[model samples]
Target: MPRPLWAGAISFGLVTIPVKIVSATEDHDVHFHRVHLADMGRVRTRKVCELDGEVVPQDESGKGYEIAKDQTVPVTDEELEKMPLPTAKAIEIAAFVDADTIDAVRISDSHYLAADGQVAAKPYTLLRKALERSSKVAVAKFAWHGRERLGLLRIREGAIVLHSMKWPDEVRDPQGLAPKVVEVGEEEIEQGLQLADRMTIENLSGFRAEYREVLEDIIAAKADGKPLPSPDEGGERKSGEVVDLMAALNASVKAAKESRGEDHGEEATVHEMRPAKRTGGRTAPAKKKTASSKTAAAKKTTARSTLAAKKRAGTKTAAKKRSAS
Candidate 1:
């Protein structure tokens, strides 16, 4: 079992469930250290005192808050620990709310809340089952790292998981970050929805960090003094601006369906562009063919046919006279 990072009790009204916080996730990313290129010597950072120009030991360093220029208030860990905070040693439940009500941006880290002892098992299971049945998450307050933090308690796989959350004030408002308003056709929106449906999956278990695997391979090759592996030849990266939005959406939908091995029944229909006038000015409505113009064209065709027939008769009469003579 993973070692617990913190030991605490959940103060759920009158019930107190002792629990241990263990990391719910793990990192598999490859880490690198700085080294000198000439001799491969490892480079390290040393903490130094700014005023005395002396290297400071880890134990000698303490937290300080800067109030003004060159003025700081030093704070010790003992002082912070002794502060009057109700959630100093326990996760005090504030309220229960629907899980969807909490914004995703406020959620930060996650940890598993395991029962600390046999006595805690009953209450832990009670809370887990209650949350599972009610389908609501518990919002709690806990003190960690010298400050009070907001947390969400929810059930996952019959175990209670605590997700650290940011305070409302800590989250920034996206006031002007949205794109400017633009016109979009109904067909384009429908195509976008179709693309989303095509790409939807049941869960995220199939995904893996392919970049990390390739990085590990590169490191192993370097350590074994072997040639680095060449990259696979894939399709060329698409570049340039998208001139036609509807066409792009149709292509995206088709690509997604093909990737998922779905049936390609029919092609996406695009809106037909209206015919416009070809002039050195603003586009005008296309001219319609009138009945008078059609009648005039028919008369010209008849006159041409009659002239051709008369010439043919005259040529035949001249040939007959020459033969008689």
Candidate 2:
């Protein structure tokens, strides 16, 4: 059980539902501390006052807004807490909109909006069910972490999930920062699509963060006083300027098909029926098969034959049993 970060009521018209906000996600990245390399001792940092050159205790610190190079306006925690803000203790519903209309880029963080108590459960359930039926989300405003935040409340897995959003001004425009546009030929585009089709997988879980696993292995080896293993060399990729796009795409499709235990030599019926582009007088080059592809095809053929043999044997045994009866 995790503790709630906030306890408040969600207000929409006359309806007020008390809810507890809990974090919906957690960090899994590896963290490291600063240490003295020679002595392997931990390193610590301290805050000191610039005026008196004295170390400042945590309690002595205060927030300040710098107006000029040497001028700062000090603000107290009590004064900030007493500031007028309607969303300080309540989530005010601003509007309702289709959940799909919300851009993923605007979402910052997510939190679970759970009913605070038994008294609030009925209203919470009502709200969740209504959102599900309408496929709508509530745009809301609330004060959290000492600042006003924009959020969206929607039903997720039978519970109300709140997604903190970034204001329009907070999101940076990529007009000038984006990559240079590259004009792609129709043949190149078709080949690229074909390669993508070959590499597509229904489940994303098939892939893992292999580098993290390698790092863990290295750590384990050090703890056990074993020699570190050599890093595996990655396949060489041709530079964009020198590479033949169509050839690369064809090779990639062939490799992908072989990895999936499919025949690389046999043309896929779909590809034959729907030629990506008309070659006119020129015919497309034959796919160049690698040694690995040949080995994969042979294994697949052997497996099919073995399965057919098993089926035939099972039928013969059943016929024998029927004759005996």
Candidate 3:
């Protein structure tokens, strides 16, 4: 069973509904060991005071904000309770807006909002189902813990999903990060897009936390008193044994065709391009399919050329040997 991160009451005008907020996400990133070089010992640091250079007790510590240099603005626990922000109990529904109104950069966290009391079930379910059916979301303001957060309330998976959002001023402009580029012609653009379409794949499933799995398996093997396989036991794989370029591309295109029920025989050259723009009643792109096809349709043209050269050399040598005989 999942645990609720927070338990509170949601308020919208006259309606007060008690709800528990549960986290909707988990992470499994690889964790690393902390080690030291000296005597091969692990290095660790203690949280200590900067000036006094001494470890502070957890109970005696208080929060502080540094507006300038190392000078911290000390805040007591009681003082923070009376601070200017609204009390962290109420969720104020400001408006109902389109679910698409919130952008990726604005989203901070996701949460599952579940009703607490049986009396509030009807209204809560009504709101949740209504949002789910209408394809709309509610914009709300919430003071959670000690911080103020702008949030969106939408129905996801038969339950209410309250997603925290960033204020408009907090979202940075994309123009600063992305630079302008020159546009290509429609024909060339289409070819580039088609080539890019060739490289797409399905959702990530084959990929796994390799190190984590290896560690876990090794641990299990040790616990069961079984001999562990050497990590590098499978020696280096030969280049010839791995999937060849042509075979891999063929398999990928075949799999894609099977899934999408598409049989893309060959890539469209410049002449075969759509929109059919022609000059002098003749296609310039059509003339180019290809002017160099006999020599260029190869996975490794250079390697083939080298092999052909070697074969010619052998033939010439055999001919010379026969003449001498």
Candidate 4:
């Protein structure tokens, strides 16, 4: 079983529920060690004191705050633990707020608050059920690592979860980060919405770290003295420049639908609306002949043939008179 990181009580008005905090998430990243390139020797970093230039051990080191370039205030764990903060030994529930009102940007690390013992079971379950039924999260204040931090407590899978949050002042305003004002067509916006809908999923549980899987394969091949795996072909490379906005959105929606095994029987939400090409004063193609028009063309040909036959007969008559003379 994973060990508890901290043990504290939730001070909910008149009720106190003892709980233990454990990490709600774990990292599965592939770690690497520094090594010398010439002989592949492992290289390690050592902590050395600046003043004496001697290596320092982990247990001998302590936390210090630098007030100035050369002035630092050393603080010990005992002093921090014994500080007279109200939340030093308990998570003080300040108020309850609707869960939707909590800004995702302010939230950070999370921990699971488990009932510490049988004595804490009833109150812990009560708080969990209250949060679940009320559909609200508890805004709380707690001290960890020698400083007070804002927290949000809510129920997760029948257990209480404490999410560390930044204070309102700690979150920076995003006034300058946005782009300049520009107009977007309604069709483009609608197509973007369609794309979002096509890409939506119920949960993120289906995803995995494909990069780490490939990395592990590479390491295993190297360790076994075998040939390294070749890169997969036909991978789509993302491009920065978009020549046509509507065309890109249409393509994205189609691709997303195809990825999810959805049928594109109906046309996409928007088509690429392109301007009509200029003719440059060129004449257009003649229209196809209708039945009445074909009859009129045949009559004109017959009249021309009759006129040629009459001219030939008149020439023959003139030739006969000349011969007689």
Poorest stretch of ten by lDDT in candidate 4: 269-278
By TM-score, rank the candidates, best first: 1, 4, 2, 3
For residues 30-100, write the lDDT of model 2, one tens digit per residue: 34579999998999898999999999999999999999999999999888777799898899999999978
Model 3 C-alpha lDDT per residue in residues 37-149, reported as the tens digit of each score: 66768777678987898898888788899999868798887776566754366677888888776687898888888888797798798788778888888888887766788
Give me the overall lDDT of model 1: 0.80
lDDT of 1 by residue, 127-211 (tens): 9989999999999999988999999999889889999999999999998999999988787776667666556654779797767
TM-scores vs. true structure, each candidate: 0.79, 0.76, 0.62, 0.78
Error of 1 at 60 (Å): 1.2
Judged by lDDT relative to the true structure, which candidate is superior, 2 or 4?
A: 4
Alpha-carbon lDDT of model 4:
0.80
User: Where is model 3 poorest over a 10-residue stretch in terms of lDDT?
Assistant: 282-291
Where is model 4 more than 4 Å wrong at Cα? 235-239, 263-325
RMSD to truth, every model: 30.2, 15.8, 21.0, 32.1
Clashes of 4: 0
Residues 101-170, candidate 4: write the lDDT tens digits: 9999999999999899999999998899899999999999999887999999998898899999999999
Question: What lDDT score is found at residue 304 in candidate 3?
Answer: 38
Clashing pairs in 3: 271-285, 271-286
Among residues 3 or more apart in sequence or in different chains, the pairs in candidate 1 whose N, CA or C atoms overlap within 3 Å are none
What's the lDDT for all of these models? 0.80, 0.76, 0.68, 0.80
Our tally of clashes for model 1 stands at: 0
